[model samples]
Target: MRGMTDLGPLSLSPVMKPADPPGEPLPGIIKTKVFKEEDYINMPWKNGLGGTKQIAIHPHTADFETEEFIWRLALSEVRDSCSFSVFPGYDIALLLLPEDERDGSASVKNTVHLRRGSLTSPVALHHNDQATAVPLRPLTPYTYSGEWPTSCKIRTGPMRHLTFIANRELTRVTATLETICLHGLHDDGECSDSDEAVHKAPGEVNGTKKDATGNGNGTALPLGDECKNPMNGNVNKLLIGNYSIVYVVSGAVRVTIEGTLEPHTVLAGQTLVCERDDDSSPTDLAMTPLRKDGRAFEKESEHQDATVLIIQVNILRPERRRHSSLSDVSSFSQARPRGRSGSIIVYDDQPLPPLAGIDGDTAASSAARAVAGPSSPTSTIPMRSWDSARHYKPPVFSSRFKNESEVPPAVVRDQLIIDEFPVGAISTVWINMVKQGLSEWLRIPVIVARGKEEGPVVGITAVVHGNELNGVPCIHRVISDIDVSTLKGTVVAVPCINVPGYLRYTREFSDGKDLNRMFPGSPTGTASQIYAYNIMEKVVGHFNYLIDLHTASFGRVNSYYVRSDMNDAASAAMAKLQQPQVILHNSGQDGALRSAAMTRNIKAITVEIGNPQQLQNQYVQWSYQGVMRILSWLNMFQLDPADLAPAAGPPSSTILCSKGYWIYTKTGGVLEVYPSVNTVVRKGDLIARIKNIFGNIVDEVYAPGSGVTIGRSSNPVAMAGDRVLHMGVIKREGEVLAREAKENY
Candidate 1:
């Protein structure tokens, strides 16, 4: 009843609004069209397990993959039990239309997101709880996350149902059903096709309906045959909006746009669409049944008999959702739909921007965008649609792990190619990279400093995350200081692992993937996965030890630290030699290079430098000496005790933490975190405060336990679940815990 119709409950948690919308609507724009049943195109489902009748889909060229289509309406056929194809970032609605069978029904078995393709802890939506699931009842609409891996099981034989898919990031979607009564309409059954009119009358629309008297001989048919079903006497107006879909299940409907005298008649089995400019506010719609030229029929006066489905979709603008209200959402780990593997925890990476193209603003990125493969900004949509063939093509990505045949013929190590560098000399080895889906190779330069005497091969990797550039300079200094003649084993350094991301100034791979999280990737995987696989197989597999260097990404800062599996003797020793500000004793099994190298029996430790995208000379020099210490400890090189001193802020007695977790904001506001990078807090100390723009404090965060601040959000703007601080629960805050770091549990 409002400007835009109020919809029923939404399926997913609400997201923060953007500071501004893309643009306003074109002036005075409104378009209307009607499509008959014959217009629907039948297509096979994404899984190829079944088929569907696509009644309507925005951007018709959109394929099964990606979130290119804003909304889609389809009638799906479920013959055998099968899973629903994953559509990771879209809102989905479904309704089971009546089908023939005794005690007949179909139920969707599960809904859960992709957990590395392992299905666990399924939420059965057939009879799901009201809060989490849309109750499955005939003709009753229910909604769920399309990202979840869903499947259907039929109670009877083959089943048919309706599905509505919409990207809430692009537009808001809602549906309602109402009956159209036939009891009070003209008995003549006269519908104006303009051609069907027997007599030409005044006030007749060029292509609209309604104009005759009752033919007493005609029988009033309600819902086709009333004897086979039920009866009612209530008529409802169409719930059309800025973007609306009017699907009449029975009887003819007359659509009359305001300020227009002409009325168009849409017969049964027809869909009428009302569309307005994306930035324009919705207007009220006028609708009635098709009858002889007569007075408009009011909904309250007629008996409901036939049904019409109305779907109202409104593009969300910043003006609609911008507010200072706090949201209830769990931290990233808990927000995931299912359990993460026992050892793999992916909480180390930074949060994505609120929207792809935006700088910090009204919203912090939600867990969804943090996990989406790649997408358009949540606040903007494509200006063009599939009205014709000349529109933007949806993004596509594919790649495979490099095979031996893909490697370069020469200049190599481990027979993954040619002549290897001689011992006792520093050389640059160009590792061939397989271009995604192409035969050409992209060479990745690896610095290999082979020692005169063979010992353990230590691999140092930096810039796996494109923007974490502190590691780049840190690696350069470490390498330049070492002379191959005195060094023992071979030391290899990959200074810019994600070249594409580095070139693009992003934190991920060219395809918007985290190379650090791909691990020893698969032969059949995404672009990032393939590259990661090559790094592990052709390059890292030769190392006896691995050191992955990193730094904090945009909008955040970190203390110089070492992340290692302290339980492992070799890993612990490597971490200790760094003399960092903090040492995190984590399992390190999250798809990270540390854990990936561990799988191949390579002792690995991740040294996180401070800041990103630029070299911090002090930290670089400090960490470079740390690398010399590690080489000295490994008997690969000798180091002078004089070089043990750091060039940075603190003297090197490291704080050891058993584990770390982010203290998140429960509300979004202008935030101020109180601690410096390595500051230690007593339990219950004030850590961060969130204030509204008006300068009044709205929320305060306190340390739940004694811990060292490893990293904290630097941006003043914060959203619910945004990081306040990465608190490392200390085993010892000021001490390096010499005995414990050596061997004790």
Candidate 2:
């Protein structure tokens, strides 16, 4: 329980704290102990839901009022509070904001200020037309009970879209350009040089026909009779080779050769094949065109939306060949998905020169003059799901919380629960986890150990920055003297992950690595990466929940408290259980250990105690009890609520950071801050000031917002445009419940 002395008054801006001594940048990420609060501006309210504000609409009437040329934006002051809506227009966006009237209906106000080119929406009075107007009262609180309209209107620019017309009504067209097709991997059967006694099965070239002149020239040819078309037969398919496979996502086509009376349609349910062969028939083989006038071989516009696949085959021929092999016949290579074969292969109208056969036969030899027709095979390949590819294993020891027996009588009898516990009691546990070879020997130790009893495994780890000693001592005390034997479950602790930096009292490890930022460790990396990987994979990779502890460095100071992303259930539970002097929710940041842990489904929070290098007994006591309270909540131990004192002050309603901004000094100088964290400030309020080294006034920083300050710079000295403070604003509008649930007996 927090006593009167443990709590600090809440303010609008962060209290100025000290800075860390100048040091080298750590190789990895480090957690900063200072609390920073800043300002956030005109965030938007979309249908009562919070989101980015980018719309700007002009009201159709003059009754509503709103800020014009908005400037110097900031957060609101009242905690978790919202004010009246102030704009109006036709439909809702068409009117300016309004003011509440005694008659219970709101009166139209004025137009809102806006930046150029921003898109705006108009509320619709009726769904059928663009010009109808709706009363603005529905947009105000009393009428809608402070609820925003459920739907918003969208308006596009007044421009016409272009349309294109084709000379002919083509059955199908492909919008996206085809991907470049390179020669594919070679793994098919080899080719031979001489046609020497090569007899292909009759169907291999059956029903082949070629329309070389686009006049359906050879449609009367008999099955297996070589046609005059140059691109027919098993030979044409063989030329494409086995390595390349193509999927015709849509459209249809029929393949035929010189001697076929009918063409086979390569449509959705059909398969066609053309192959390369080494048959050395002396007479030149006739070839067939797969299509005529860009349409399927012999069919009309029947399967425009059909799709098919084309796979290339590899053919290796032997050495020694003749020039007849190259010519044989000419004309027709380009074919469209829906027939259309008018694309000429112009290099004098010839296909790519086939590779020299394995026997070194040049293009000059062994020409097979026979035209094989349309009898080819079709195939289908299965597709895989992308979601199933992202599955990952849960962390080690993934288990739910279990109830445990009460704390031992000896611990209660010894007054350990009542007397102020010492700091650093659990320090050795961290060291022991690493020292005992239980944790990965990385720059950041990710280990957590549970007590013997059946309580929750509260994460007690320190050195998010290797040098912060306050948590070190506080944890040491909890583990050393506390009767863990009576405690339920275990108190998982990691004393020093940055072992090298701790000895020097610096923020980074000796290798210039920071332990905090290197979360979700990499599988392959530098020493720091490996360490991070090992820790997460080994230590932290095993726990279900966590608590990362920190303190102000030698140069700074901070109020004792706990940080949480109250949006998370586990985090909220920890914050309430710890019962710190002040519970600051909305403290989440991406890439932090807490964020990473949460991403992996781990419950976690960051606890910040007192600042400065000094160890205050009360602060230490607060830390101890907070841990016990957490353990008690987890059923690791039991304690009397009656013995506990009321929290330091009325629990401030939880404020959310709808938006935030940073304030930097214009010139390097000495800085002084006015508003402190939790202190509410009015718009345009002065938040800080700057002075030269000689104490000459240089500039004064005013609040760009009207919300409470959650954090600020602790260092007094600053450079031109140096960050001097941070602010956040509450933009939520509606009834806010001020009650919170606590662990009850």
Candidate 3:
């Protein structure tokens, strides 16, 4: 009964007391209340599968038995395979909480299965089913309709999750769950007076300054001069919807709403609820640390780094009732089958319904469409069984080609195909290139591999610069070794996108243009432009995710690293999963393939392997392992024991640099690089020294800033203003780096 006090029904008195009219200086004040961990209400699930710790419910005093509440927020734990309680008229959003282990080594095996209509039916045939055989990392939230009798199976042990449920007809809910690490906090019991002084006022320490809009970088800060008072701490503005809730997973803090001067101290594992004011204005609130004898505890030891989960529930217009005929019900029932083993099964003879339109589009043209949109497409494609190694036949093409119209059609099977390749098979296609004369023609080699099951379409292109040969064999091995029967998606690989450059052992195409710089190319442009246009339209545009592999150009060597825009959550997540030795947080330059793909909303990343022109076996292996990790992370394929690299320790520590630069030589000479790739260097550290033909030292290059070497020029010869070393400046501290680096390929 400690935290279980009944606050009675929410009051509208505060908003009704306001005098401000529309467009006035001030709107109505919001009513906010704090609910501590001790006050949480424990309730049994209606289905008896598990129990939930109720944080707050609408109508204020509504209990679990109260059937008319508009929205509800709670935390639940699943220990075994149990059916979820069915709420026929509600929609639910669930987010899996990260485990306590910081190294991400904890074992977590949880599987979610969903079925529509009845609880008596098996839990198979759910489109959104996901199994986490490996540890479950914090991912984007998963949402489903409450009409479905969803269930969870704990393959290894128990799992905890935060959930938001709302009435589908009367309310709409949007939830985003992210984990932010607060650095510079000490874990020890010692605290300094200076730390407490810094916490007395908001935006006073550790780059916490707020802009004119009351926003501090990505952190939301309190608005106006109201935050200047030490007693008030810092105030933050909240535009409350029908209801708003903020829950603390770790650490402690204080909160105060506009109507009251007294602040409420909310510790870790506590929840705060803010009810919408009667008037239609945003809310004002302030937050600070729990104070003891008028002094704030600022040390991280007193308040560990916190991860807060924010949820918003809004009231929307009621959904129109749909009248379904008996035939409609029967057709849907055919797709849902009840099995004796409590596993849902789909019949082979049942015809699949068309994919529901995403964003109101009636139909999707390709597999990529299913992933980019909100809905999954219905596929009639049956799973095929085939021997990938023995039966695979690389497609052959005739050299004599008249025009683009003469290109052959892709081989299709099981509703899945990639340009001349059938499902569960690997084949090659000869993409027509420019001709030297009327009789002689040129073509680029394209490898296409289609998986047996229906999933997203992923495009992988390597050797775009022609001279980058490390990726060519890596692509071949990936395509040849995949067990098509287990794959859930399609794989399209282009071993050599620039055939002319590869044949000529150069980085640019025959027209002396960088192929990578000409993306979504214009059809009426130059030859390279036309080629780029064809690939973007016929290939890259249809991909949900793209991985463009490359190596350091001719004279340079690079550490096994990833170049990605860290600002993007999705791209950053994918890059972290690869566990590379290093990562460059770069917003790609203009016209780059990665940049072009992003404009079209396709998630893409560029991977830098070893040196160019030669296929280093070690780098090839590393590249292969990295790609497998990506595929596994996406749930496109299961990780095979043979394909698994040696048991990895904690991921290699990652250093994120917002800005990076290349050190250029001031005088022409023969260059000698002193440090290897991935070596950390400080300003004035010896990086390289240039010598003239007579063996006399010409100039010595020193590190310009404290950073790690990502790439360096390998060729001995150098010219004035020529880049010799590329370094990334380290600015953030306490950021987790992978503990150990993976073996270099």
Candidate 4:
């Protein structure tokens, strides 16, 4: 035991342990040493390809600071640049790494940022081919590269980086390997280029881009000799043919075959390759680097860009290689005539490795068909292909409202209980409440307002359509101004109807069903229908008089009017409450709550005010003024109606028609209406014309009989048989004519 020092107190010096061991370095070589700002050569390579700078590093150079190659331009700001290697006798693996974090290797046709240390497979190619090293932004769009094939038969897309194997000794270059650290939950495990990458070609134009100038054919070249140069006893042996395999590597990649390179996504640690050989079945091979490159590379760039490593390996028979070099093996080459169609087969000369079968190495070659899925015969069946589909579960609907008391009451004069309907009636009633960031568990307050004193129940509703928000605030203003303290009756103000649609700020509900048309709906119907039913049976049923509020749909403007069933006592009573510019005495069709209310001897009138999708001060004011007038009439509020006539609502001509004739267009086209609503037309009158976009007449819509035009199409566009106009015949006109003839007698 150590003894303590003398003095009041003594502190021990803290001993430091060595920093946690540096992360285990990745498994492969970093060919291009993590570049320095000085490593980028300012000198340009001027060829027929134009002036381009280059940075060439010999194989197996060991000076690496990071796994990623970081190069910066000397310009004021960095411009996007591409790096490539011209391997005359062998294929080199190259990845397009962008410093921009927004770039993604997975994205098609757009720049996509990727996580650090992501990599793609080795891109293979023929000898002496100048392939693209990378892609850039607005300046060097993927489309600007002349190497990218353009097809009128297909939609154009961005060009991608190319990795190719040269024509010589079938060199096998694993992608510039990178190690990715797993974070969050996106842990699929580390991946690297599989043997499949070397044999696969890029994607074909998606039928949208057809190469009329390029030859669509396949040719087979024989390997008379094999390259004996070996870094290790284990060397990649690729059979001659069009092979489909996922190049397990990083970043973006492309495979060019028969002159067209198809784009593919190469993810880090995982293989992404396709094997579809023009000859025989696609072959899958393992990508193993027998040679050691001492250069140290960053797993990711300092800027956090991704990297990719690719390999192309060719195998030759032992007998063929004895007489000549690997390039001289032309005896096995066979050139098919021009326009050769379909696939060709190249037999494998060597035995498969024992581990290859179990490791699913052959699966990569089979995976080629997986790209097109079951539709392509070349695809191998996926492991899950035979599995049964899991059962689907319906969405569970929960109610936000707990109970009756939790229901909020939009109280008016602090007494009348204007209750909204059940919460389950609308699927999205709580959507607006959610956007307001209200608790899903908390019930919303009912919009109805009431008077302090009890009397005849009078319900005022506005904005049956959600887009008509103007009516809601207008009714709110009207209810607030009412002095219900002196009221002789109960005034229930429902400031909003079609609440779901209102939340969406649209005229139609979430189901695209109009809440207005779904009157007296079934209890088991959809949300919109259920809402209508609940309001009619629960809310409307409580009142002796009902005023349904509404507004024109978007793109429509109309004069203020009141719709009431003629010859009905309640309808007549309610019609007197609206001081509208036009009081239309109309009969209700089936499913209308007003008609149902008429059956119950309850007064109900639907008031149309303002336009859809927008609110107007004048309309709101008019609505407020009209509501106040009605309140005054009922003695709920005391107010002097000077400008507004105190006498009933108004004296207006009653237009009657047993049947309304609807004029429909015979063909689909644009409709041009000459007469507006309220225009009197005779039978066979040209009410409208339909013409195609080219201005050629398609059809003419004519009036069926003498009548007044009451409605016309609001939308200029129309389909065949679409109703263009409606004509209301005046039976009274016939009566007047007959009466004048009788007076002559």
Candidate 5:
């Protein structure tokens, strides 16, 4: 039997290791090697329609024609319709290269017909019966399985494409290709032949002349005074897993590695390959544009920039183990030989009770059960303690509270007894769950601050939608400012509720479930549900009041506002305490934390800060102040009257609306918003305009009712039905009618 090594945790596997020392490979590491363009093997395709340039192959010894390779990358040109090679167990990905510049929009009428089982079979992949064209865009890749006798026919003239193939049973491979045109680098606005234009010396356009000082034609601007490649300052380190290849598409670049003395010049149509031990430190490489003649320059020079396509490959193995600090244990069955008597047992070299019939099962069956348990050869098993039960210490309250004997006891006195926290102290607790494979634990941090005096327990949760990061700092500030000993009651803060999404920099769980929608979650449900259940049961149910912090979704900006069920006096009062510029009378959405708390008779409101993903300091500070104000209003904390700033006159009466709608664009184009968030508008007011690529206005979006803009799209590109603005119609004070009558056309 083959013994497998276990990698401790999945959370740490994706992190790149630090750079290794020069010239030494780490132990147990798989080595990587780079393959250059000139080194690629030139051979005829299996179908012989055109030749193929084999980029790299796994197991180095595998030949394209004779031996079975685990994976391969290659390029081929198609001049005529042709059959493709059949690989019984391989998955294939194909990318169409840019159309030949010489072709230049002559209505080439290109179509690629694909058949799965045989060349004579009907099309297996097509848009419709009338359209057989494979939408092959430049640098855009299409992936398909090559397990059967698959082939494709190209109707247009000669076209070149790239292909990637990997054995479905052995390895997984992914490829991405993008081309960045450097036409903007030429200030003279002159075009040249494809190859010559790409290789032109920096600072010198084809039709332009240069003087002794190395400046281009007087009319053309010098390529920035220093001539430095903008990419030189970037960190371009690559971790060599198994094998990796970088191909220059249409530009020249200088490559510098740690151990190399001088940077190597790589030109268009060339490749720079590097092979290193997988477990070794990362290989840091700096790439910049190469000067003419590949000469080294101390200062910036006139050099054209190039676009490069990088492809990374990793060889998969069954017993792969990652470095970790956790301890690994061996189960009893794994330690004993096959057919061993189950009646015999040992613990720390001491004999224990026999395994024969403790549970009324036969010894042979018991042995089989042990082998079928949750333990695997490649799993990191945890060792059990000699003592079967755990002992927990009791928490002691602050001595200062002993003198106040007249004070009434808390309604939930036993709550603190089970909790591992001392009264009048701030501490953190981890809510842990067994991961799916029982290979690791998923831990969520919960910060708790208990007060010596009894008052209302408040809960603050942020990052419910992981990308809404602005509220994270607000919670941090609230926690830091509240002195546990002086605070009344208690404050619980969960700075990042969606741990998985926060780690991945996304807005949802790994399973694609929205965490916010899994409130009052079920224990037997999905991952998000389990997490939500634990939080609501352990933290939310104990709160007397709750503030759920959030921000706009990605690519959108929002003004500071509060959303609460204004019909409920308690919820309405909590919303008003935030002192936001806009207060929306919204009944929290079902499954939302705020809604769940409201049902529990807890006053709750959601604070909508600025943008998502990024922490805007101004908005963060604003949210922090808002939270502090709420605390002061509840009498949970006190501040000197003299220190309070003067209130900004009478607040614009809170905008009351039954609901709001996000206005979407009817057409797709480059959108230009005419108003910012919080701007008031009348019916028919122009809110945005869409322009075609040619700078012609295509359409204009106007407000359908008198309302205030609470949110608007920040991304310039828009597709049909993409939300462009979020408007809240004013329903109180007759403001809508007055504005409409005043702005009558």
Candidate 6:
């Protein structure tokens, strides 16, 4: 392969293959083509959005409008905030580069705020939540699903970027910008290691930025002017896939494949494409930076800077198999009753899972059976996993509550964990959750409303899942509106409990662990566990009753609903007072904050407000009213005159359900959930549909049983194992469990 200096299209040699391959290129000498600046195709973007500079495609003449290529690359220009074009079924990777030589101030203002699918969809939110931004360090490659509605806001002047899109079904692509100092002293004094590269160049170093020189993974060798000619050691090794591309981001580099006898010199703006055999182990290469004279950079020489973008691609790699896009269940053989709200619909499809039903940790296959079994069941119709659940005994709270380990609730001495029940005061304070990295602390904002008269402490927490924000305003309003002078009890509101997740605007904690599932966490465990333990010990322990406020996670929508154990008189009372459209008699999901609170003899219930990442004022008002009603019932406060009336509309059709489960997608595609929140449907009714990028419907979801929709997936983009619809079964009016629960509780 020749490295060309002239900007002209070179004629093909007789043995050269087509630039675009039909499928996987046939086994032979690797073929590649370079597009000169003059040959690059520049045109208006899709929908006349903006301008695009393009080169390199699988189908040399593939149409981006039709999304017909296996992969495509483009360079885009941006200045301020910008929205990215949505491309279905393709995985997108981007690299940020400077518009020109930059200064120190630009570094601070150049970072970009990136978001995918508006709220990171169901999978990203569940699996990889983070709030950190991608800095404008030139050459750092960041990737996301192409179909997601992605956008970025730049803090500074004009910037240019490289956008790479690869077909999810046919290939894998990854790019890393590395700073290589082939010959520089590892120590402060003299020559040391041969390869001292900042492997994670122009980007994050363990999710943090160290300096402007790009020493992400390791230290960049110090280079001085005094040292001159030096000896070359064994070169740094770079692993490659079917195609290994070396694009010189800055300075120059001397590159040579292991088998090649001669080395080639590549200049800045030039990209070297190397191809090897299919399914072969990554190719090892000798790569070294070059001096201005084109010779290898010497140890301690003035050749202090060199950066390269190494992009690897594999052909014909099949995409991962997704959960079934649709699942079917036979008719409900029996409808059993567990409580006033519990309408247990026993279907033939879902099997019994483990007896220990965890609220937040259930996987796709066992999702339906994860709901907490009733404290006492009237259901003659056996539910899934009931055989095992019948053998398990519930935790009995004594005078002093204890966890499963029997660790007594130890009153903590820390300033925030311990409370001073001051009379007639409303106070707001920030409590540290955890220390991030070296110095940053993620803190929770707590609002405490203490009444003049001593009474039970009620804890209200919101945003346990970062994106679930509807409850945030609801908590704030209740705490602010309450009259502490006349109130009989204390009210504590944790507006944003999962601070890292809230800041990141995703569903999970900073470490990507679902904080809701790590309750009563250990003092020594994973990050999420430690944080969870702290909340239980420091914040939650202060309350005698807990109202864990919530909303839908990313890519999902929910109706106002309450999940509470009807067996508990106080919890059930709180649930009914919320005025939710639906009440599911879920004792509590294990590991859920509400459930964890219950173990401490703290009456608890979970209140789901609405869709996430938004302040739906209507839902917020409803939630505020619900909390106020609960407070009034507890004799904590007198209700406002205006709140005496029910919600704005005709009283909502509040349905009571015994059990619920989320249906999952079988495959990946664009999805449309047909059922709206609170919609009632029968076994054969259409619930949702999925379509391939070409617009042909690939899958259709039918209702598994007659039920009211509790919540469902909202994002149009779908992947296997993502949510479909939350189905809540309806019980006959005046069921046997309803009469028995009131008497027993």
Q: Give the candidate number with the greatest TM-score.
A: 6
* Model 5 misplacement above 4 A: 1-419, 433-438, 640-658, 734-745
Residue 2 lDDT, candidate 6, scale 0-100: 10
lDDT tens string, model 2, 1-745?
A: 0000100110011111112232322222111111112211233221111122111110101011121110011111111111123111101111111121112322112222221122442222222222453322211111111122222221221110000111011111111111100110011211212222122332123433212111112323222233222222122221222112222222333344323344543322122332122341121122222331224233222212222223222222222111102112011111112111221222111244443322224332222111222223552543221111223532221000000111110111111111122121111112211221445432333222234445555567676675566677567545533444345555666666556567677876455766566666576755555556555655564456777777655434444556677667767888777666445554444445666677777788777665544455445556655666776777765654532445422233545444455667777788888766555678898888888888888888888768665456677867786665555555457634233311100
Residue pairs in candidate 6 whose N, alpha carbon or C atoms collide under 3 angstroms: 131-504, 323-666, 324-665, 324-666, 325-666, 342-658, 343-658
Worst 10 residues of 1 by lDDT: 398-407
lDDT of 6 by residue, 278-386 (tens): 5345555655667654555444544545666666766553222111001110121112221111112221212344463334443632444445345357778765443
Report lDDT per candidate. 0.60, 0.37, 0.57, 0.39, 0.57, 0.60
Scored against the true structure, residue 418 in model 2 reaches a CA lDDT of: 12
Question: Across residues 1-745, which tens digit of lDDT does each residue of candidate 3 receive?
Answer: 0011111111110001112232222234454567765566775432223456776655343333422445666777654344455555666666565443322333333333221112332112132244322222232355666656443534435556766666666665554332222221222211222334433244333556332123443343332233342332232436456455666654555556656556666656677766554354666554544423223444434433334555665555312101111011111111221111211222121234344322333343343354454332574554322221233432222111100011112222221236445565444566665565565556666655566678877778888898998898788667745655567778777788888899899999889999888887888999888878777776678788888899989888887778777777777877776667677776665566887787788888888877888876656767777788788888887877555535322135766655567888899999998878777898889889999999999899888788888888888888898888888766477554332222111
**Residue 135: error of model 4 in Å?**
61
For residue 100, what is the lDDT in candidate 5?
A: 37
Model 1 clash number: 9
Which stretches of candidate 2 lie above 4 Å from their native place?
1-455, 480-482, 553-555, 581-589, 640-662, 728-745
Pick by TM-score: 1 or 6, better one: 6
lDDT of 4 by residue, 1-745 (tens): 0111111111000011112233321222111112222433333211111122222211112111111111111111111111122222232222333333323444332433333333431212222233433323221101122122211110122223322322233222222232221110011322213222211122112321111112111221111123222111111223332212222223322222222232222333223322221223333232222101211122212111133332222222334323112112123232222211211221121133232221233555456435434444565764323222235643221111001011121112212233332211110122121122244321122333334455576777766677876677666555444433344556666666566677888878668987677887778887677667666765667778777777767644444556666456656555655655545556665555665665566677777665567665555656566667666666666764542443223324434443345667788888887766555689888888888999998788777789765555767788887767656556564443221110000
lDDT value for model 6: 0.60
**Pairwise lDDT winner, candidates 3 and 6:** 6
Whole-model alpha-carbon lDDT for candidate 3: 0.57
lDDT of 1 by residue, 599-626 (tens): 8889999998888776665567667877
Q: Stretches of candidate 4 above 4 Å error?
A: 1-449, 554-557, 576-581, 617-625, 642-662, 731-745
**Where is model 6 poorest over a 10-residue stretch in terms of lDDT?**
399-408
Model 4: lowest-lDDT 10 consecutive positions:
7-16
| Model with the higher lDDT, candidate 2 or 6 | 6
